[model samples]
Structures are given as C-alpha cells and as structure tokens.
Target: MPKAQETILEIDRSALTHNYNYLKSKLQSKTKFLAVVKAFAYGNDAEKIAKHLQWLNVDYFAVAYTSEGVALREAGITKPILVLHPQIVNFKTIIKHCLEPSLYNTNVLNAFITVANEEAQTNYPVHIKFNTGLNRLGFWESDVDYIINKLKATSSIVITSIFSHLAASEDANEADFTVNQIKSFKVIATEFLSKLDYKPLLHLCNTSGVINYPEAHLDMVRCGIGLYGFGNSANEDKYLKPIASLKSIISQIHKIEPNETVGYNRAYVAKTYEKTATIPIGHADGIGRHLGNEKGYVIINGQKASIIGNVCMDMIMVNITTINCKEGDEVIIFDGNNKATDLATSLNTISYEIITSISQRVKRSFIE
Candidate 1:
C-alpha cells in the first residue's frame, strides 16, 4: 500500500480474502458462510467491504440494522443480506429492499408477520434467533412453540434460518459454558425443526466459535472480526492478517524547552526538553482520551513515539524526541505489525471495540 498523505484507513482486500479463506477452511464444504458486515464493516467502509465479500461468493451477509441491509441492497449485494436487528418501523423498508430480518422476539416476529401481510407478500424469507446464553437478544426456548404457531398462521413469511450467539467461544476457561450453549441450541433446533415441515439453515458460530467449535458449525457460520483479520486468540492470529491499517502524516514538530506545557489544560509538562509531533487524528477520529498522556504510542520511522498530553478532537501530540523524523513523515496508528489487538490490550479493551470505533471522517484507500 502507498504511504499515507493524511489520516486514512487502508483497506487491504487481499488480507480480507485470506482471512475469509482461512475461516472457511474450518467449515465443512457443504456448510454456508454468512459474512457479518455490520458497523460499516467494523468502521472500514461497509459498501466496499460488502462488495468485495460478495465477489468472493459468500453465501450471505449480515448487518446490525435495516439501514445497513438497505445499504448492501443499494450496493447491488444480490446475495441474501440478513438484518440481525430490525426495528418494526423499518419493516416496510426492509421488505422493499428484499432484506431478511432476524425475528428474535414475540413483538418483532408478530410485527414482521403483520408487515409481510400488509405488503401482500408470500414466503418472504426471515431468520429466527434464540437466546442460548447471550441474554442480549433472541427468544427463549419456551417461545419456540409460540414462534411455530405464529409462522403457521402466515404464508406471507418463511423461516430461512434459526440461529444463536455464542457468549465466549474464544476463552478457554469458558469452554464448558460455550459447550452448554451449543448443546442448548442443538436441543432448541431439534425441537424447533421437528415442528416445521421444511428445514431452514441453523447457525450459531461467530468468528471464534468457528475456530473453537466444529460441532457447533451446524448448517452455516457467521464471521465478523475474523474477516477483518483478528482470530481472537494468539494461536489463530498468525493465520490471519488485519485488513485495516490506520495511518497519518505528521502535521508539525515542536521542540519544547524545560518546563514547557503541551495541549489543553497543560496536560503534559516537559521535565526535560522534548520534541513532539502533532498527528491529525484524535478523539473525534476515534482515538480515545484514555490513550493520551503516554497510554498509547504510534510507529514513527520504525520507532515507538508515545502519545503525550490530552488528545484533541482532530489532533494528537506524540513525544518523538528520540525518533529521527520530521513533518510529512508517515505515521502508523495501527497496522499488521503494531496490531490493533496490541492497542486494545493496553486500554483493557477488545479488538472489536477499537476497530469499529474508527471514525467515518477518516479517508479510506483500498489495496485492491
């Protein structure tokens, strides 16, 4: 990829392909693959990422909201786009875009059925979500009968898949918990499918689950972070490559004298003389305030330059005294080398939070 001239997120398509293939290798040949492109494909340009995955012949695509599904539809994603969470208000728009909704609860299932009837539709495909362990969303095991009966009343809608979320498939300590969740899902699936005449696809594995649980692969798998090049474990990370590289150029360099202060509220005071570089990226650009005052560092001329003082809305000052660098030099916020995982670890966070937090205002360039 070319050097950054400004604050830009470089999207490496080749890395994305490699990650997809790596994850795909873990599944059975007949199993389906659903690529989760929610949160603007984890804040790396949804349309672009979705389009590339579509080209890879991914079986399906998943987004968190109706708008995201609609965006995929508008981008010419003909392969099924699953709206993981759909508001009742957007039901009509979702139908209009041919986006499938994951009916997780009584209200959503009933509301979607009503909308399907109003639209005068027939066999409109939808997915069912059940809460195995993740209490965040989905219906309970007891709701299976209610869902079956609800579906029995409507020819306007059809269940395409029944799925659940894995709470902690990545953690070894949570192995038993993960296994129980998978077992619960299997029991739910057996009962749910036995009642219906046709069989829809069943999926429960997220990225880490895809690696850790082969038995839970069911009929399909949904991959999100893994496609962005994070395997959720050190053992699996070497097999994948992160697709987004946040980079910028040094706007200016300041030579501070002893006792000099920097940034808002004089957050950093020079005990000894130091040189600082102002980078055109900060809180507004998704660089959090917690990263300020030496919590985070950037790669300058292959050397570490620790971030100093408070992070401003659109700029961050880094102490680069020892680095032999100047204005307009390339700066690596996070890349395959100084990984996003490393940055997130320093802040006691996860790679998912850090990558998805990248602001939309930053320019994007694709390594096609």
Candidate 2:
C-alpha cells in the first residue's frame, strides 16, 4: 500500500482466486476449467499465475503459440496446454514439450500428423477446432468427414477435444448469432463424435460464454480475461475483482506560465498557468500514443490528472495544476477502482487490449 518508488504492476492472487471461483460457479459441477495463460498471462507474469492456477486444480491451460506452451513447460507448468495457433515448424517442439496443438485446418492438421508420426507418438492428445462462425482459424463444417478420414489414417495422434470459438457471446444484441454458432458446433460435434469410438471433450465457451450461455458449457470452459477480473461487461464486472494494478511515482513537478508547451511537437500549450508532473511510463511501456492529449488521465492522490501532450516512449507529462500533490507522489495508471476497462473505453478499445498492452519491462509484484 506504500507509495510506488518506481513504476510497478501489482498482481493480486486473492482476486484471481475470486474470479476463478465466480466463473466456476456458473458452470455445471462436472464441467472442466481451462485457464488461458498466453501473452504472459495477459501480460501479468505467466509463470506465477499459471503456478497459482495449477495449485487451484484447473483442468487445462491454453496459449496462443507453441513457444508460449514451451515457456510454460520450462516454467514447470505440468497442466495440459492447448496451443490455440500452432505453426507447422513448431510441431516437433510441441511434441517435445508435451503440449497439445489445436489442429484447425488441413495444412496444420496434416503437418502435425506427420510430425507426430516422425516422433513415434501414439495416442498423443490434440484438439480439433471447427469454424462455428469465427471465420478466423478453424475447419469448416463440411470438413468433418475429411478430418475423420485424416485421423483414421494416423495412429500417432488422437483427438482429445473438439472445440470452437464464440464470436459474439459477450454482446446481448448478438444473442441469436451466438446461439446459432452453438447450434452449429453441436451439429458438427454430433457428426464428428458419431464417427469415433470414443468421446473427446466438447467445449466452446470462453469467459463471457461461460456467463451468458450456460447451455453451451459443454464439457469444459476456457477463461482468460474473466480470470483476470474482467467479465467483458459492466454487470458482470462487479462480480469479479481485477488482479493487476499499474502504479508509478511522480518524477518531477513543473510550474508553467501561459503558452508554455509540454512534451514533443508542442501538442499541449498551456492556455493558463498550469502545473504538470512527468511520469516514467509511456508508449514503449504499452501506454500507447493514443492516450495522450487529455485522452488519458492518471489518478494522483485520489484526483484525476489529465495527460498534457504527446505520450513519449519513456515518459508522459500530466496536468496536475488542480491536484495538491508534490514530486515523488504516487500516480495510478489503472487500479482496482480505476478499472482498465474504463481507460480502454475512453479510447474505443476493450479491457483485454488495455491490460495485456502493459509492457514486460515494468516491475511486477505479486500478492501471494
């Protein structure tokens, strides 16, 4: 609770526990939980977060790439990691780390089958992704038979789960679209499962899907942002607790006369006598340049101070003329109270973008 001597991100383990529990409460008792820990656990210390989640007994873990899965393995994470987007080149490495890859297309599917055969892997677990509606990365509905035929030709790998992504589960207006996507996945699952002798797990729900569509919580649920205290909506946000807070210290205070400019390109010219404070965080630190010129503000001693000018790579000046604060005072970028979603909303973005945008250079302190 002390004033930050330098820029630091505090990760609260208890909040994470609360979020996990809350999200779990929405699912059936038999449903499994998969924690997505890619992007450095959404840029909040992946090793620590995964360790804690593992201790909490999550059923599985997911990452965006093969290298991320490898990093988790190197960090001593033993839970099954589903690489959402595994490249062909990393298939061998993925087998080496015992990480599961989501085979979404013919190219990746065939390449992985070959790699698995080369590695002499028998019954190695993998997941198949179907394009319910996402249109991003997934196999079409008509590809079920093709996929089954491909699997029949290979004994090196086995389908451990069948899944798809929901494109608009968080938007109420997209309810019909989300429902149809679920229906499509069900049809695909029926055809896909009927051809096999065994039943691989069927899952589609992400964080918002877990909350909004309980019927779609098939066999397991995957949660990323919700586990970090964002439910993708205000109504649900209150039920969760944000686990990370970004804080910095005021480097110096400035008293400027009228017409005095702040930062580069003279983007902010003082129209009246103003006081500003320089902060040691900027675009390079994932603050982004768009949050400059009053678009973004930091909390100082419980008062909001608008950013003065262009966001520098290493620093940002904020107008603290009305704030009765001095040098070395605490500056809050985003905290439990000043949610990252709020900052993101100001710039027409989402909470996930804002939170994950935090740079790795910042010191991370975790509350165990």
Candidate 3:
C-alpha cells in the first residue's frame, strides 16, 4: 500500500478478529461480549471498528459519552450502545438516540428516570455501575437500599446490567484488591437481584480482567484495549497481534555541523557532525513534547533512528547518520516491530494514551 502524504494510522481488521477470538476463548460459552468503542475505538475509527465487531456478532457495544453513542446510532448501528458515563443534561438526547446509560449515582439515576418518564419509556434498558473499589464512578455498597428504592418506584427504566470496574486487574500485586472488588460486586448484585423480580446481566471484567480473572467473567465482559489487540501483559500480549500501525514518511534529510543545534529551544546540539531526517509528525500527531531529544526513536527502513531534538508541533528530527535512507523512505513510528507499549513506557504512560492521543488530523487507513 502507498503511504499517505502525512502520518497515517493503519488498522488491520484481521488482527482485531484475532484479539476478539483470543479473548472469547477465555470466556464461558454463554458469556456475552461488550466491545468498548469509546475514544473513537481507542483512536482507531469507531464506526469502522464497530461495524466489523457488529458483523462478528458482538453482543453489545459501549462508549464513554452520549455523543459517541449517538454517532453510532447515526451510523445505523442497531446494536445496543451503552453510554458508560451519561450526563443529566443529555438525558433527553440519550433517550432520543435509544442509548443505554450507566446510571452510577443518585442524581444521574433520578434524572434519567425523569427523562424516561417524560418520554413515556417503559422498561428502558439501563446499566448500573457500582463503585466496588475503583471509586471513579458507580453506586456504593452502602447505597444499595437507596438504589433498590429508586428502582422499585420507577418502571420507566430497567436495569439491563449491574457492573463495576477493576482498578488494578493487570497488576499481580493488586490481585487481592481485585478479588475484593469482585466479591463486593457479587454481594451488591445479589442484593439487587433479591429485591428485583428480574435478573439483569452482571459484568465486571475489562480486557485485563478477562485475561487475568476468568472466574469473574460473570454474564457479560467488556473488552476495550484487548479488542484493539493488547493483552496488557507480556505473556498474553504474545498471543495478540497489535492492530494499529502508525506510519510516516521522511520529508527531508539535513547534515548538521558540529555545535549546530536542532529543533525549538536548541534542544539538541550536535557534539559532532550528524545527519538528521525530518519526519512529518510530532506533538500534534500525539508524539508528546517530552518524547523528543533522545527520549523516543522511530524505525526507518528497519534501522533504529534516535529522535535528535525537541518534537515540533508537526515535525520531528531523527538522528539518521548511520542509516542508509532518504526522503520519502517509509518509517514506522510505532507498529508491531516497535510496539506502542514500549513507546508508552518510554513516555511513562500506557498504550491507551499513546494510541488514543493520535489526532484526528492523521489519516486512518483500514486493511482487511
């Protein structure tokens, strides 16, 4: 395939299927799968990714905001889209789009109920997020009584699922904490079931939770990073193929004399003569400012080139003195050869940040 003029994110559809099937293999036959397509499918075209996942027969889809769900609905995605963190102001829009909201606290819960009532919605599907230990979002265990009372008084909305998030499922040191979170969720789920006439789907596993804690698979599991081809662990990562490849082309090459500096703020001063290749991608393309001046490197023609100076808004200069390459030669910013996780580690972040930080300005090319 020909390279685009600027940086481009190449998404492999087959890798997505491979990751999905690998995660599905860890689940019980009856467990349903919810693919988290929020953040534009981790910054890789949500509608395109969701369409493929839907065709794969994924049982559900989830997004962090209401507008994301609405975008999916506009794209003609008929599958149930769960708005994980819906706001009170958008309750009407959420209802109008037929998007299920994750009612975490009393205010959001009550407001959603009011909207459902006004719209005359009956048994409108909604998910309940319980704060097991993450403490980010969800109802607390002590609020069980309040939750039951609220549900009993409202036929306008129905609890489709009761779920919680694991704060550290990937960390072995925090396994005990993850277990406690699971136990708390189970207790809360049981209490909810005892009060209600019907049983909603129960889920607590994210991508890491799915690979690390199989027993807590529950009724449905949400796969986010895993679906995008990362297992969050070395062992599991070996089994999954990274689906996104960020690529660019060298725009020009420059010969720098000794004592000559490169990029903004004179970030790099050559102690000796050096050859630098200017690539058409930088902080604006999600390569953070801190990733400049030898902090990060990119592969050009299968050779490693250290980033020489500060990353500019739309360009980066790489030390390519030893590499045999020229302008227009292909460069892999971060791909299977140089994993996004490794890049993230260098930046003290995660693959999610590295991948999702890629701007919309960069073209996205999908390969099946």
Q: What's model 2's overall lDDT?
A: 0.94
Task: Please give the distance, in angstroms, between residue 12's alpha carbon in candidate 3 and its true position after superposition.
Answer: 0.4
The model with the greater lDDT, 2 or 3, is: 2
The 0-to-1 C-alpha lDDT of every candidate, in the order given, reads 0.94, 0.94, 0.91
Q: What is the TM-score of each candidate against the true structure?
A: 0.99, 0.99, 0.98
Per-residue accuracy of model 2 over 1-368 as CA lDDT, tens digit each: 66789999999999999999999999889999999999999989998999999999999999999888998899999999999999998999999999999999999999999888889999999999999898999999899999999889989889999999999999999999999999999999999999999999999999999999999999999999999999999999999999999999999999999998999999999999989999999998999999999999999999999997999999999999899998999999998999999999999999899989999999999985
Cα-based RMSD of candidate 2: 0.7
On residues 1-368, what C-alpha lDDT tens digit does candidate 3 reach at each position?
A: 56545689999999999999999999999999999999999989999999999999999999999999999999889999999988899999998999999999888888888889999999999999999888899888888889889878988988899999999999999999999999999999998889888999999999999999998999999999998878898898899988999999999999989999998989899989889999999898888888888989999888889997889999999999999987889889888668999888887888999999999999999997
- Looking at model 3, report the run of 10 residues with the lowest lDDT sum: 1-10
Instruction: Tell me the spans in candidate 2 whose CA falls farther than 4 Å from its real position.
Output: none
Query: CA shift at 299, candidate 1, in angstroms?
Result: 0.7
**lDDT (10s digit) by residue, model 1, range 1-368:** 67889999999999999999999999999999999999999989999898899899999999999999888888888999999989999999999999999999999988999989999999999999999998999999999999999888889999999999999999999999999999999999999999999999999999999999999999999999999999999989999999999999999999999999999999999989899999999999999999999998999999989999999999999999899998999999999999999999999999998899899999889986
Relative to the true structure, candidate 2 reaches a TM of 0.99
Where does model 1 exceed 4 Å of error? none
